[model samples]
Target chain A: MKQRLVSPVRMVWLLGALLIVCILASFTLGHYPVPLGQLLGILGSRLGLPIEVSWTPQMETAVWNIRLPRVLMSVLVGACLAGAGASYQGIFQNPMASPDILGASAGAGFGAALSILIGLSSVGIMVAAFAASLATVALVFTVSRHAKGDRVLGLVLSGIMVSSLFQSATSFIKLVADPNNKLPQITYWLMGSLSGAKWSEIGFILPPMLAGLIPLLLMRWQLNVVTMGDDEARAMGVNAPRIRLWTVLCSTLVTAAAVSVSGMIGWVGLVIPHMTRRLLGADYRCLMPGSMLGGGIFLLVVDNVSRNATTAGIPIGILTAFIGAPFFLWLITGKGDHYEH
Target chain B: MSIEVSHLSFSYGQRQVLHDISFQVRQGEFLSILGPNGVGKSTLFRCVLGLLSGYTGQVLIHGTDARSFSVREAAKHIAYIPQSSRPIFNYSVSNIVLMGRSGSLSTFQTPSKADEERCAWALEKVGIPHLARRCYHRLSGGEQQLVLIARALVQDAPILMLDEPTANLDFGNQLLVLEQAKSLTRDGYTVIQTTHHPEQSYLFSDRILALQNGRILTQGAPSQVLTEQTMAQLYGAAVTVVSLYQDKVRVCVPKHITIQEEAK
Candidate 1:
């Protein structure tokens, strides 16, 4: 067992294979079950693989246009949340920090809520949600920019303030919303399902996700320095303040995009980074990518459970909350108590 | 190697902390700063290190303005050992010392084999090579302080800045670390350290600087700066300074009344 303790490197490769298996399983076994070979044939047909390409047009549409995009969206959003979470944790020097506390996810939720309450179109609603999340993070960044020392503390306080302001604004919109039509739409969106995903939404999400994740991958080493304290970081020749500002901007944007599309997928961000930290140690070079992969696989499993729950379509967020709440309590009370007050 | 500070004055907003603090140390000299509490010793060092800017007058290192240097560039020439015990984690002793090398390395490079060797050499020099593998927090307060010094040693800069390097040490570690710092000056490394122990400063330092009220009261050889009149003026107490062994060493005993109270 001791010898089997996989380094983050080996574990990442292992998780990659497991994710592939789960992805294949989830795609094959959804409602109106496509056979594994037929699903493979359809996927192979799309990629120009030489085969008879067995499924009908409607089956092909369901598998390729619907299931595939939804799964891909889950993977993308999951990886983004976990990566953003780890980045936030490193920036704040607090293990409990995640994008939710930093106003990215809640900001998006409030934005979408406002749009639904105001009777906007689908694309307009998505844009509203994305913009609101971005705006909230920007507000937090601006307010906390001048705080002397403890930039993370400045961020959390400002984020909570912004979240509350937007949340109240959303409540006001809901109070005035058309209860007959708008309210149900708002609540349904808030429940958060990949059923709403499409190729265009995926298009909007991928750029910000890639834009943020790539830089985080490259600069993971620098994040390690800043976590040790900015003065200590500057003493070591790193321009800690500049690095922090850039990272906060990138991470905020990615988390905002994820939340805009996925409706505040809880626990992936909080749990993934903590799990990565425990499994991988504190080295960001390993932890950053490890969190990303682990988050993708974890979300895939949860999404699979949501699809297969007994005659009830479970909200993936609720599943995460169920798993996350206990794990969070354990984190606070268990071995990770060093992070808490 | 030569450090020259000309008429340096600093303040936090309206309240001045260091005023007209002028002093110089020739290349490869070991100097100790001694003063009563709240005498701006740390403030003076911070000015020289350029951590606190907007101070009047110029601090010139090798005839260049200290203010002109970036934090990294300044750190490249000077290694600062701030007072320790601020860390909450159990970073290893060797790892802590190896952090001294960070300023010199590029952004992407991890600590190299040579850096590890320097860390080893520094730990060995401080006579705690065995403790190199131990967790920093698990060590005694004295050992922890020495580990901090070992970090400074590995920095390999020409000038070492220490803030009360022995404040928490046991008597033996105090003498040990000070002797090690004194020996550094022999190899052409300049040392500027603050100390409450005037006797040890007199024993190990080439010069002593006395500061009070955000200004330098006196700075010269130990004989000139550690005089009875200067001690009385700086500390604002009636102090008796005694010399022995052909005036090679001076000791500052409490003003007899304080000593009496200690006996009681």
Candidate 2:
């Protein structure tokens, strides 16, 4: 047990293997069940390998159109949320910080709700959400700049203020929405789902997600020092303000991208980093990558269960809380002394 | 001089925290700033470390204006060990110490193998090599202080500034931390520290600077600066400065404690 606790590299490798298995399982276990052998052939054939085409045309269409996009979105969004969550925790030096701390998710939700009220296309909703989320964080930063004392506290308070501002705007949109059509659409979007994942949406969100994740991954070491607090980080030559600005900007970028595409998926960003911290100590160097991989595996499995648990598809945001909260409680309770409140 | 502060003053809006304070510390000198809580010792150190700006006067580290240097360049000249704060996350001792090399590394770079070796060497030097892989939060206060000192060691700066390095330790642990700091001064690092205890200044510091309301009240060799009158004025309590071990050491006792003993 201690051996497992000590070796984060090995655990990361294990998570990597588990993710590959989950992706393969998620591919085969969806609504239109494709067998493992034919699934491999389809994937291989798509990659230009000369594999025999024994799968049906509908099966291929299901694999390409529905399963592939959802699978990739789950993995990509999970990694992005978890990575951004870990970065937020590090830069803020607050364990409670998540990707939503800066109002990105709330802002994105409002954007989607407003776009839906205006009857925008699916892509238009994603774009509007992306824009609104960025704007919300920008407003938070501007407000916090004028706040007196403690930059971290200022950012957090303004974030709460702006987030609730946008949330009320979303509620107002819901109140005014057509009860027969737009209200339920807004409610379901707020709860979040991956059922509508499309190849085009994936193509649009992927670049920004990578753009956010790469800089955060590269700056993991700096993230570790930032956790020591601003004065200490600066004293150690880490340039705390610059690192903070970059972290907020990047974390906000990834979070906005994730929320715009997947709606307000909650618990992954909040709990996944904590889970990874328990598995691989709190060094962001390992914690960043670990949370990324762990998040991907978790969401993929959760997404699979959400789709396959019953005849009707459950909104993933609800399931994430239903699944994540209990699991998180179990993790904290077992060897409860290890965690700080 | 390793560090020079001349006519330094700071205010937090309407409240003046520090008045004109001037001092110079030479390389290889252990200068202890002695004061009670809220006397602005920490604020003074912050000014010296370039963590604070908008002061009235100049702070020079190695004869260069502190404000001109970037955080990295300032760190290269002087490393700081803050009070042993309980961190939110539990990083390993080695990992915590290895962060000392961050100033030398680029923004995108992590610690190299050489940096790892240097961290190990610092832990060994601080006599906590066994705790390298142990979680930092689980360590005793004394051990944590040592870990921070080791971190400062790995920073490889010529000057080390500690903000009350022993404020929260037990009696034996306090000596342990002070001795480690004194040893660093012997290794030719300029050490400046703040503390409320005059005995700590007497035992470890080559010179003592006493502060009252953020202004320099007195400064000189420990014997001259820590007299009974100065101690009483600084703490607002009568204290008897006692010489020990053939005048080689001294300690202060509150007058009431001595009176109570005599009554007993």
TM-score of each: 0.87, 0.96
Candidate with best lDDT = 2
What's model 1's lDDT at A255?
Answer: 89
Fnat, one value per model: 0.24, 0.70
List, residue by residue over A146-205, the lDDT tens digit for candidate 2: 999999999999999999999999999999999999999999999989987999999899
What are the per-residue Cα lDDT tens digits for candidate 1 across A127-207? 888998998888888888876767768878888888888777777777787889887777777767666579999998889
Interface RMSD, every prediction, one decimal place: 5.0, 3.2
Candidate 2 has a TM-score of 0.96
Interface RMSD computed for candidate 1 is what? Answer: 5.0
DockQ of 1: 0.30
DockQ of candidate model 2: 0.59
CAPRI verdict (incorrect, acceptable, medium, high) for model 1 = acceptable
